[model samples]
Target: MNDKINLNYLESYAHSFTEKVCSEYFGTKKYMSGQEIIQLSPSTQVNLMVIKTLFEKWNEELEMLKANPYFDYKDMAVTEALKEFMNVLSRAIKIEKQHFIPLLEVALIDTVLLAIDPLVYFWGEIEKNPSPFHHLKASKKYIKWHEKLFSELISKGDHADEEAYKKTLSEIYHQHENQLSSPHILLQDLNKVLPLDWDQLIPKEEILTETAPIMQEPAQENPVFFEEEETPELPQETAAPAEPVDYRTSDQGEIDAPKPSLGNGKSIDPALAWARFEAEQGGLLKGPIESLEEGIAINQRFMFTKKLFDGNPDLMNHAFKSIDECDSFVEAVELINERYTSRLEWELDSEEVNEFLHLVYRKFDEK
Candidate 1:
């Protein structure tokens, strides 16, 4: 009658379709009651995280039953529960994991059916007895299922609510947005039975031409597919080599600006600009730098000593008095790291700290 009924209908449809498909193909027997597929109550809002967690739990249970034959596969109740559980998990896997962890081509067909519309493939009459289960389904079967569902649910005398029907279809589309391989086809099929303007719901750019009906071809000894023709290549151009521009160093023997400057007279050297920015930002580091004052002092002395001997370990002498005092780069880093850590509280050994250090080093590497 409303959104609630519409939502419930989809939930029921998914469950019923899942159970029917399982029974028809997976050697499962029909049972009176099946496990819940979509666990969300009518009032609960659907969330991706919640759905993912539910799917993970459902998958774990399904796998447990499937891996051990000790769990009776023949019991109608067990079989039905397994099918419904798999249906729920399969939907979730399709929605989230298909792109990441894909199945083999042979298995993906039934898996997609269990997710999209299991009822039509499982219950409706088709050309093949076993239906191949991998090929495109006959268009007639799709049309028949559509008409049957519409007549029974949407077009019935008192139950016929056009708005509810549209809302339900919209919800179905939204839910399966990621999972359905061809939502356009489903919309086209639905348009055949309903009087509603289905094209309006689909943007013109996405609307596909009517797919040709699957032809019933006789089996051949050696079926061949036509190879695609390759386009001719364009002629190559020979170009003069260009000189490389130095990004790190300027003619003034200072770091260059990270960004290119416009032809304004107020252009600034990048290294000096970066140092000024760091010093200005240092004011925010008072609290954190105070906490790591010892580590900073030790690191600073190490850098200062290293600079005095030109990075030569054998020339190190803490007692040498002739070395001139210049501002240490690590001091600037200590301030930057402290400021960042005050807000985010990252460890000194963390990947973020390592990356930040490398970025700072690269800024000074031009010299």
Candidate 2:
């Protein structure tokens, strides 16, 4: 509530978090104050706005997790919490364009707190101490215990330099792989664990100092050298072709055409965006669909879907019709492709628009 109290709580939470991780990774019992934690690297420029924003978001998610019906879902709740923390850390870093370094460090600290430490601290107290207030009160012993259910509730949910954060952390962890331990070792093997991008986040000097030859293995083991395995083609099923319409004729039924919305601002039509997304992803429907569901859930959480659902009711119905009627996921996507190809009107074909459409469609799927 009060400024001083909030600041103290923030620092204390961070301190406990950092201390646990540092103790595990560096094998040091040193108590790092929150300020010291923030100052781990001389290059990092701390931003209070970024730090406060991170804490507020984490706290909100933690509260939601604490209220989960643990019995019904079994360990689903626990695993969801860990995954949620991972998502938060990755996203916090990915989104913070300005204070990236500081945010990345702080978020890593929180990730270790929520994802790793909780399996030890919170799970022990969770059954006995069900209330979020009670769990939070035990902060020193169990940092953010409530975060165990963080990923379970309705949520929203990466890549490229867009993933500069993970790349930065992987580099840091790999550079110090020998010096660090346990989870730090695990974090360093990021490519094996999860994919990330952006090599420009860290200073060259720091990266150079730890230039001990990183152990390399066979092609399969080394992600950098591992060639992308070509996707196996699915057995094609022929369907009766729909009546043809010349997409180049006009912008009338053409959803792919770029048009100014009600306002003068040029916006890609949502209908067209969905089409291009399916087109680009091609047969890769599983990953995109999962992402789409997550984005839709987030939109629902933020109340962004209500107005769209209220207005374009039929459009929404038609979209889901593809989902329900199509034989397979790829078929579902093919339906989208067919819909767009029939009405396509864009002058130039841009892969960039396809990429952007893939991103936007995931955020709002038709019900």
Candidate 3:
């Protein structure tokens, strides 16, 4: 449970995992599929799932902003910048070793922090020592809220009573589970921390560079006309155009106007793009649940069945199907209360129950 023990274990596990992946797959494949990812250790699977969830939430925010009637021309730049940022993140679809390694490293750190102590993770310690992924504006707000809540909970509880501490944390988490599950609450604000030239942070091979155009032979019967252009002449005293200034840094060591890269008319709805990408990869669904009829995701299904249903696949399937048949979230909750909760004598405030109910709520709580 100590920090050093956790850090050593994580480092050793990650090193071995990375070496296995590189030697076994990196030699031939450019991207790792979700199916392949599912075969990884449970800890790694959960970490990747966290990364995927963050990406989906980021995409959802962009879509929300893009659809606003009040969205103005000024907002368009931010929208497009976010879209491009999502694009770079979509590299996770065909995640190269270069991209995957860094992402996994950050994710593992986050996992360790959360596992070791939720209080420490939410107390702004993670924010103070941020990785690129942690430089999110929403994260600051999220941490601040949790920090206050945890502080209050600690102040009101017996510090000597570990069980009391656990009970208080669970109660607080359950009380705010709905808000905690909402995606927008954690929506990232790229303008706050991400640099204008954020793409440069990625590896050269992982960047989506524009490909060179191919030259085609022109037909002699219809030769194309070309307009000749004159080149500008430089003065003898010209000093190499002053080495082109970078607005991110100035002589005064302050940022000037940082122009984020706009989309090149290639921006598409992130949800649609992910749908196409997931289809091509033939992997389990990684995005948000659009409908219960589509069924619970593989990860969720396995997790819920194991954790809540006592590894009863049939019970899990039937419960989900029954919940899906309900016309509304209220009806779904009633059904769970009557059939599952009451019958199984489930603890409503338990983390597993809250997580399961949260996913059900997501199915019906459409924006």
Q: What is the TM-score of each candidate against the true structure?
A: 0.17, 0.24, 0.27
lDDT digits (tens) for residues 1-367 of candidate 3: 1111123233444455555545567788887654455343333323343344455456457657767887573567875775566555544445677766655554544544443234334332312222312222223222223333344344443232433433444455444333321111221121122211222211121322223222121212211111112222222211111110101101122222422221122221223322333333222222346665363422344446656687566687788888888877667766776676656656554444544655665566553
Best-fitting candidate, scored by TM-score: 3
Superposing every Cα of model 3 onto the true structure, what RMSD results? 27.8
Please rank every candidate by TM-score, starting with the best: 3, 2, 1
Give a tens-digit lDDT track for model 1, residues 1-367.
Answer: 0000111223233344334333443344222111211221211111111233333345457557678966777789987776665554443333222221121121222222322342322221221223222111212111222332322222221232333333333333333233333333432322222222322222122332334232121222221111112222223222232211111101112222333221122222234434543443212112222112221222222332233234332333322211112133444444443333344434444322332333343333332
Give lDDT tens digits, candidate 2, residues 199-304: 2111121222333333221121111110112222223222222211101111112223442221112323444445544554221112334433332321121121
Candidate 3 stretches with Cα past 4 Å from truth are: 1-6, 33-41, 49-93, 124-367
lDDT score at residue 118, model 1, on the 0-100 scale: 28
> How does candidate 2 fare on TM-score?
0.24
Q: Can you list the residue pairs that collide in candidate 3?
A: none
What's the lDDT for candidate 1? Answer: 0.29
